[model samples]
Target chain A: MGDRERRVVFVTVGTTCFDALVKAVDSEEVKQALLRKGYTDLLIQMGRGTYVPSKDSGKLNLQVDHFTFSPSIADYIREASLVISHAGSGSIFETLRLGKPLIVVVNEDLMDNHQSELAEELAERNHLFCSRPQTLQETVEAMDLDALQPYMPGEAKPVVALINKFLGFPV
Target chain B: MGLDAFAAACCAIPVLASLLAVRFAYVLCRSGLPPTRPRAAGLRCLIVLGSGGHTAEMMNIITELQKDRFTPRYYVAALTDSMSLQKAQVYEKSLIQGEGEKIIKNAQFMQIYRSREVGQSYITSIATTLLAVLHALWLIIRIRPQVIFCNGPGTCIPLCASAFLLKVLGLGWSSIFYIESIARVKKLSLSGLLLYKLRISDQFFVQWTQLQQKYPRAQYAGRLM
Candidate 1:
């Protein structure tokens, strides 16, 4: 726990990018609160998002590192103490796999409100917090890492079992 | 071997091997073997990856399955998907360092053109698919994975299809395990539907109960988030 105090707040919006999520993270209130909590660093993986903040997003006295798409986010996920991301399945599942405190920002503008379903489902399970661009500040302030549910392995057991059985292979 | 088995092997293996070298007929005559059974443990696996979520979900699978049991893993994805390649490389490295397991470094990046390309003619799409078929056949032949795992993605189709063909012919024994993406709640993706309808996938798993109930064939794995 002592070593974790220096970890970064990872904000990611997946491969295609969602400016909405990036904008939500670039708020004065969220930055001030995070600074007060002794978190001094922010890492954002913005993907192909078009909106770039002013020349510097480090105005709030927080060290910020931002990039467009990382080859592998595993290292970032591992280093993060808190993760704020778009409700892309890849980001959500990867964050959950590591049992990080995650705030999923659903891109509601998608064709079917598709991302909302997973975000809402995880929220309902108390696995992670779901936030919207409108509520980002408050949600960031209210996050409780220990309160989030830890992920369990084998959500694919029945399927894996059946595949092995059908193939007459053992697990 | 039984008389039928011997006769089929004699006629199938060499002919199919030779046909795979032919320009276009290779695509049409690829499936020339029977379904090879896998034992309880100690099997090589080829995990088909799509970019983004497909790769993420598969990496989770690699972390879950006992490493020693599923040895010499091979991950395949589209040639252009550097994200998938990078993630696979990281996962493979982590597995080796963390678990003290050795992984094969040569990954298979096949040229699987998307089935639904916007504004592209059907003929062009078919040509690309035929190309993908040969590439996948070469992969399946080389890796000869006892089981192939995939989450529903268009890129996964060609490899899974080629594996299905191997089962149809009598020369291969790779089992196709298709797991629907966690995002699918009500229905299967195009790849899932195709694999299910063709009855090629040995086991189909769905994350949501609603999806399982809708597709009687799909087994539910308690919500993989």
Candidate 2:
């Protein structure tokens, strides 16, 4: 059997905040910073990543893994050591459930700073590390995985039961 | 002379009376009397509030309002989280772009009762309506909008309350209750019945002229879209 790879960095750039990530990758300095931190490969899922099919182009020196859509996102979440995603409720909640350390980037256009609000809330609760494109490298390097441990590998049954009760169903 | 005819006539009288009363109240409120004149432009700001299919229909009116001189702002208080609020915002942004109007996608958690059981569905509909009314009231107070354009499914209650409050304060504007084309074409539900009470609007915009005739007090603004 092949040795299972641990500490895989899963990068998602298909969220509303894709532009920022794109801008970050386009910068030679950020690309070098990511390589220095040992994130050897970049998985560009969604957004502008899909449009640019050419591999080994632009300032991004790392291997480019692109996916249009995945039927089983949970499988990917389970396999990854660190999950980088847009500040979406679904992505944040799912990553926390899997016990994976999450780094979130907020989408600016969705609303007047809703992503920032969610990011701050999650950060305050010590559940995730959130950083903008400009500070992505610093935030990634300074991540405290221990802080996210309490939220990892939890079942959503309690939340489901709460919703069921609110809906007047027997929980 | 027949017994059936007499019963029909008796029922028609109260319906007609209520309709007239609503019309009279609407006219009294719509007319800018003395001190109310300054609030005329305020009244012109028609704030349409709803979620789902009703919100989609309201978007059509918002489009027309854009073409005309009257400025219309939209408040889309979504009842369900199943659909992305961003999708609704995108639609609103495209529809209201460069018009200097705003679309507020306020999220309200609602438990939709989808069972086919008639009795349970009816009760659930009533409960949901009450919750939406409460939400609408909260939004109305915050926005302080002069006129409320309600496209319903229980979100009208709070909006109506706000309109009522504004009227009392002499900042009273108009409310135009929109009876969506889809509801009339499809089967009627309990929520549709709740809408009958809100037949009173400063102006009621509907697709059909027959509805305007039935409630003679309502002005036929033609097809809103």
Candidate 3:
């Protein structure tokens, strides 16, 4: 237990995926699985309860936290080992720009399946890993930062120059 | 057939023939012209006249054109005075800053005369059309452009009418009307119907293949953007 390293998962669920994540965290099967895997903490957000420590366990080693709105989300992304988030375009773009591994959960019922479409497109382009509820864990585990490095659009120079030239500016 | 019916049919023949003649002339003129040469020398200007989502798309095209040889000018008219005008200005400045040449050198926010009730829509449209016609006439007189291009909805009606009047009055410039994407999606609007009545424009650029089959006067420019 002392040798186990600490890792944080940053999650931002706008509206639709909030309930699903809560359900996943509340399930006994998921909690037991995490416990078995030596995971020390669970950050449950959007008014969900914390992971209760066992009677004989030392200091309730696993802790779950919640956040309504925190300005420190950007700082969290810099510090976190992995990011699990909704498939919003802004979030996806920012995460990719920062060179971080992302596990995007698509909200099916919103905006004519735009999130799903965007996620699938990014996946096809090998930019990021995407999943629905059933395969979220697998998708998260499958996210290889090294493989994603090749796909990330490195610098903003090319796109910026293209836009500028289109606007009738000298390249 | 009765005498009145015979007389009516006689009147229809010339109308149909004249329509056919216009169609033939358009086809012949378009076919004879060469492909749009990228490096063709002249200050080629594309004037876009709409202020909405369509205008945003047009801005994208203008941006693309700025990268190329054509110089683009945007003339925006809309029912509301919201963020679209600001967006256009931003795009204009950004393009100028980046290119060191003004792609959208001239942009005007034309006023839209609004109507509250359904009945007033017609009156509103007529007044707006007349105002636009006068404005376009002045612009043509001042600028004396080589070609006037129109992407339709509200702005096309008056601009096309002004262009036709200029042509009829013996002005040497040519005009091209670009039918909007919505016309391809569904039936023509009231403005489109009115544009059909003009009858003297140099060319009609339509997206649909069926438009060419129905009205042979329309040149199939594929998609302008």
Best by lDDT: 1
Q: Which candidate is the best by DockQ?
A: 1
Per-residue lDDT for B1-225 in model 1, tens only? 699999999999989877655623433333222235445566778888887777766776666676656766787777766668777777677655654534544334344445545457987888877876787778888887777888876777878877766755646766677888887765678889998887767677778887788889777767555
TM-score, one value per model: 0.68, 0.41, 0.42
DockQ, cand. 1: 0.28
- Tens digits of per-residue lDDT for model 3 on B104-204? 45544444432222235676767755665676666556555544445554655555555555554446344343444322422333554455544433444
TM-score of chain A of each: 0.86, 0.71, 0.68
Per residue, candidate 2 scores C-alpha lDDT tens digits across B1-225 of: 599999999999999888777765765555332233232221334344444335445555544442232333444444443342444456556755554544322212222322222235776777766666666656656555544555554445456555665655545444444443332322222333444444434433333355556645433443322
Ranking by DockQ: 1, 3, 2
Reference contacts preserved by each model: 0.49, 0.00, 0.00
Which 10-residue window of candidate 2 chain B scores lowest in summed lDDT? Answer: B106-115
Return the interface RMSD of model 3: 11.7
Please report the candidate that would top TM-score against the real structure: 1
For candidate 2, what is the TM-score?
A: 0.41
* Tens digit of per-residue lDDT, candidate 2, span A54-156: 3464655455565655646668778776777876555666677677888887766553353465566567768888888788777876776776645533222
Per-residue lDDT tens digits for candidate 3, residues A54-159, read 3233334555565654545567666655666676554665566666777777765454353465567567667778887566655544456667743433232433
